[model samples]
Target chain A: MSLDKADVVKIAHLARIAIDEEMIPEYTNNLSGILELVEQMNAVDTDAVAPMAHPLDMVQRLREDQVSEENQRDKFQEISPKVENGLFLVPQVIE
Target chain B: MEWETVIGLEIHAQLATKSKIFSGASTAYGAEPNTQACAVDLGLPGVLPVLNKEAVAMAVKFGVAIDAEIGKRSVFARKNYFYPDLPKGYQISQFELPIVGLGHLDIELEDGSTKTVGVTRAHLEEDAGKSLHGEFQGMTGIDLNRAGTPLLEIVSEPDMRSAKEAVAYMRKIHSIVTYLGICDGNMQEGSFRCDANVSIRPKGQEEYGTRAELKNINSFRFVEKAINIEVERQIDVLESGGKVVQETRLYDADKDETRSMRSKEEANDYRYFPDPDLLPVEIEDGFIEAARAALPELPDQKKQRYIADFGLPSYDAGVLTADRETALFFEQVVEKSGADAKLCANWVQGELSAALNKDGLEIAQSPVNAEMMSGMMQRMADNTISGKIAKQVFQAMWAGEGDADAVIEAKGLKQITDSGAIETIIDDILANNAAQVEQYRGGNEKVFGFFVGQVMKASQGKANPQQVNELLKSKLQA
Candidate 1:
């Protein structure tokens, strides 16, 4: 399925990123090319082929049901770009 | 307009592995940032991921847990995505051949109705790093600490009809993951997360409606709210003769609404091809057999056994087996106390759960342990403590840091079941309450309770209530 410019605009808006209008045509063109490639797989006689989920067959491996460690917020916060009173600082995006 | 809510989910859970999936980096959380990310994770050029044996073992373990078809051989593919967190140019995931196949999970709703949700697949993948947006005026902060963490992506079919069922399905998944020790099931730390795909169609329509995918539902509450809002939004659009747009949306928990981030493009085809760097994983019969043997009793089987073997009601068994730790604790109590199984289940479900809830703690951090609880229950059975006193003893035992008998002795909380001593106290009470005693003698039978109360008070509220009642009734009749 070759999606047009309208499809690209809509998908970007749903995913919550502000996409520039100039980027729309390029994205649309690129996505259609991908869809075309996936179409090649469709030509295979896969009607009887079961959909594959994972790569291996295995069973249960259990832990000793113990909590071994705690998160180091102090250490993690040290790497944050902006920290105020042990809390991460972010730009005000909402009114 | 007639409509039906269609929902599916993609659950990402961190596997319980001592080492990271692709690299041998310690899977241990809370370490200093940049410490755990190895050369492979840091994307030092030419650094390749050496698959962790534990990670593969866990993947197979989960495959067996879900009763899914496991392929003898599985392959990994490269999913190309450019982001700060995904240090590798592409994330190596099981695109074509995954280890676990289709499975079904049965969920029980609060209304006592059961629904079956189909698990489309469970696959292995590496985690991306955390990107902190809005950290600066003109830039975003990137934390590469979480990069390359092993994740098990559990995809569910569009079998759920309502938000209630979606939540139910998530809870069942959560229980299984936690029970099997595959995932910590912590939403806050994002050890576990769910992405919801929701759409609405005519109630009986065979063709599917356009769907929207929402990410960042880190908690169950968020999942339910995000799906509900999205479902309503889709329904409203359809009813107004407007076409529902197919796109990806992010749930803004603060606003409790989903606004279009961007229109969704049909870009699922990432040109997935087999990853050549790593070898295909081949599991043998012995491997599957070992995994099966290691499988501790699953929740469903344990629930059934709890009901049949312990003579517990269905609800009680469900509550006890909801988490593995609680069930294990109950078992230990039963083993030590050798008390009635039903009563042991009661203490675990009733008193133990109450305390755990009050403190917002899991069973591992609970002040009460199984053996101690069993000792306390024994005290109750032996009449060493009354029901009312048992609660007091329980609290004392919880805070006192000792066994039930020790706490009882230290607090001097033993029940007064001495018949001769109780008779003396009862006689003294009768002498003092002469007017009430005379009335009781003249056939005001209820006055007997007042005398019994006096005897209990004389015994400092520890008098055997049943014995006091019997003695008071007989003495009053005389």
Candidate 2:
């Protein structure tokens, strides 16, 4: 359940976070501590208990299926870093 | 050593609702980029998602149509991932408990046999926006119009042993969804699409081999080809003493090959947890009853009814009921023309289908509709036109000439049922073709066809064939 320095680096890369070499030990210890907590939680015997997806027992609110929104492309794209031809532009993504 | 191919399909069928699943933004296709994306769909901070009632009803309809167990309560979860198209950094989907569970679809195979494919589950989810790559130089354009659209992701068990079975299963789902009017079932527009998980193992092996998922294949043909190619690739890798690597592959239809898109090492964790903003969906007995009552006659029931009532062969019934429009058109033709059920089936599946295919039109888009077909069949039944001439009339009708009677009259293509007119044509043929007549008299029974052909040709192909034979026989004997 413990994360080492290499594991921290890989996790950071997957999360797209930039971390300095000095911060790897700190991240490893913090992540491993969380994992150890999860391990301790998993050790409890609860064979008869039903798994719950949410803590609240409330039901979902249903909405009417109608087109109630107006076109706000110009206004929404105004906050983007880049936009062209009514599209939000981002740096090139390689397939 | 034989290899057994295993396949499972995950189909995404977009619900035919007016608005997005979580927002009131328009779900209409081909809207201006980002126009239909409201604040909720754009994933603004503090915005909550409200489930659309119509979308839930459509999902329930599918579950009922497939005879699946409807989950009384299902929870929505956030599938965390990072992509340019995913503005929210996650997708709202059902994880552990889907709405529909443990159903089986009975598919009629090409060999006139039926096989049941197991459906693991069908869950409701929101689609991501499209990233328009390669169009903008050094940048990608994102269109969020498709984001938040409702999709029912139907997952199947790995019960398919061949590509054909997979295709049949996919097509059966397509027909059911379209028949229910829940999905438009347009694969080219991506309203309906599938991802195939394929693997191969030694024959009779209990354990499954590593599976490679082929993603986002739109057409049934592509689904079949992609699975076959992937199966072959897996078999090759296994035979070469190399273990198959589990990965996600993309089917390049143009090149007819599947290449690795991403391997397991690079795959996303997709940490899924229940969304706190949206509550668990609770399906009451009233809603389930309403959905059941609203279910139309599905394809299987329609096929069985066609077989039982119309006395059609299983194959004919299957073909007619494969599509709702075709089955309705067949029924209308039979009801209007009062033709025999077998005859109606033949004309619809044989002649009408051929004509539709020739023009690249669906039955709904047919220039010669069911009424026109009934008229043509009625003409044939009443001896107004022979079977041969009816085809000509059909062509004329399709060419926008007129109805069956009008075409037959305008072209003088009516059958000449008068015995006297046929006798005259036969006598004229007998006189002109003396050598063939003598050959017939010399006990050459096969030469009779030549006389029939000549008489019909002299009569401008209007000579009633039976009458031509009868009259020509009496005269030659005399």
lDDT of 2 by residue, B1-478 (tens): 7999999999999999999999999999998899999999999888889999999999999998988999999989999877888889899999998999888889888888889999999999999999999889899999999999999999999999999999999999999999999998888899999999999989999999999989979999999999998988888888889998878889999999999887434756887898888888999989999999989999999999999998999999988988888989999999999988898899889878999998888889888999999999998888888888888888898888989989988888889998877877777888898898788788897888888888888887788877888888887777
**Ten-residue stretch with the least lDDT total in model 2 chain B:** B262-271
Estimate every model's Cα lDDT from 0 to 1.
0.79, 0.90
Model 2: residue B466 alpha-carbon error in angstroms: 2.8
- Residue A40's lDDT within candidate 2 is 96
Chain A (alone) TM-scores for all candidate structures: 0.63, 0.89
> What TM value does chain A in model 1 reach?
0.63
DockQ numbers for every candidate? 0.09, 0.84
| TM-score, one value per model | 0.80, 0.96
- Residue-level lDDT of model 1, residues B214-298, one tens digit each, is 9889888888899999988887887787898878788999999998766233455455767766767778889988997898788
